[model samples]
Target: MKSSRIQSFAAGVLIANSAPHLATAVTGRQHLTPLAGRGSGPKVNAVWAALNLVGGTLLLRASRRGGTERWDGDLIAFETGCLAFASWMAGSERWLRTNTARQE
Candidate 1:
């Protein structure tokens, strides 16, 4: 049960995380990534996005092994993870902006 919840949460986090990168890739925008670091190109972003999507899909499948029996709980956990990631991203952006402003 715990494993399933964890997997669902991770899947949600990864899936949500991939959306921006994929959008950047499609729009030909450069984005920083852990893999390639600063100024990563669209091609690299595309690949990174795909990897995240695949990983998330796999985790989702693993978590869904329980079928529809306990899907409500799984969905809640997944949404919570997504929300957590969103909060982190927002906070990171604010932190970066503040630090950048301070440095100038």
Candidate 2:
């Protein structure tokens, strides 16, 4: 159960992380990614997004094998992870924009 919850949470984080990169990639824009850091271009971001999406899916499916004994707990943990990552992303993006504006 604990392992499953952890997997679920991690899966949520990875899945959430993929969305922004995927959206950026589709727009043919560059985005910072762990794989290529600040130099990540659209193609690189696309590949990074794919990797994260697939990895998260695999983790989520695996975690589900534990059954629904604690479904609610798992769901909450997963939601927390998703929300946490999303909030962090939004905050960081805003901070970066502000700092960049100041620099220019």
Candidate 3:
């Protein structure tokens, strides 16, 4: 019983931490800017977004494999950070695309 409880708690924590990453992934897919008229800004943002996506995917896989027994706070924090960054990048890309489209 105790072990199960602990497992549940760890899973909960992991899920909570990973939620932002999942959200970011969705946002990234939805808000990707076009390749055209990217200028310098979109290129930079794309790099960041790609990094974030990669990081998030890696962390998610780690979390799944690690499970409750191997849960690490640092990993969770890193994942959360990556997710937040990804979301910001996605938003930026979307904005740039919209503005560029309007100008053209």
The TM-score measured for candidate 3 stands at: 0.30
lDDT of 1 at 77: 85
Tens digits of per-residue lDDT for model 3, 1-104: 33433333444444443444344344443223233333324344455446545554554554455356564664545445545555665686577653334554
Per-candidate TM equals: 0.86, 0.86, 0.30
Predicted structure with the largest lDDT when compared to the true one? 2
Off by over 4 Å in 1: 98-104
What residue pairs clash in candidate 2, if any at all?
none
Which residue pairs clash in candidate 3? none
Q: What is the lDDT of residue 66 in candidate 2?
A: 48
For model 2, give the 10-residue run with minimal summed lDDT.
Answer: 95-104
Residues 36-88, model 2: lDDT tens digits:
87768899999999999999999888998948766778888788889989998
lDDT of 1 by residue, 2-90 (tens): 88889989988998889878988999877777888777879989998899899999998999875776687789888988898878887
Lowest summed lDDT window (length 10), candidate 1: 95-104
Record all residue pairs in model 1 with backbone atoms less than 3 Å apart, i.e. clashing: none
Error (Å) of candidate 3 at residue 46 is 0.4
Cα lDDT, all candidates: 0.83, 0.85, 0.46
Better of 1 and 2 by lDDT: 2
Steric clashes per prediction = 0, 0, 0
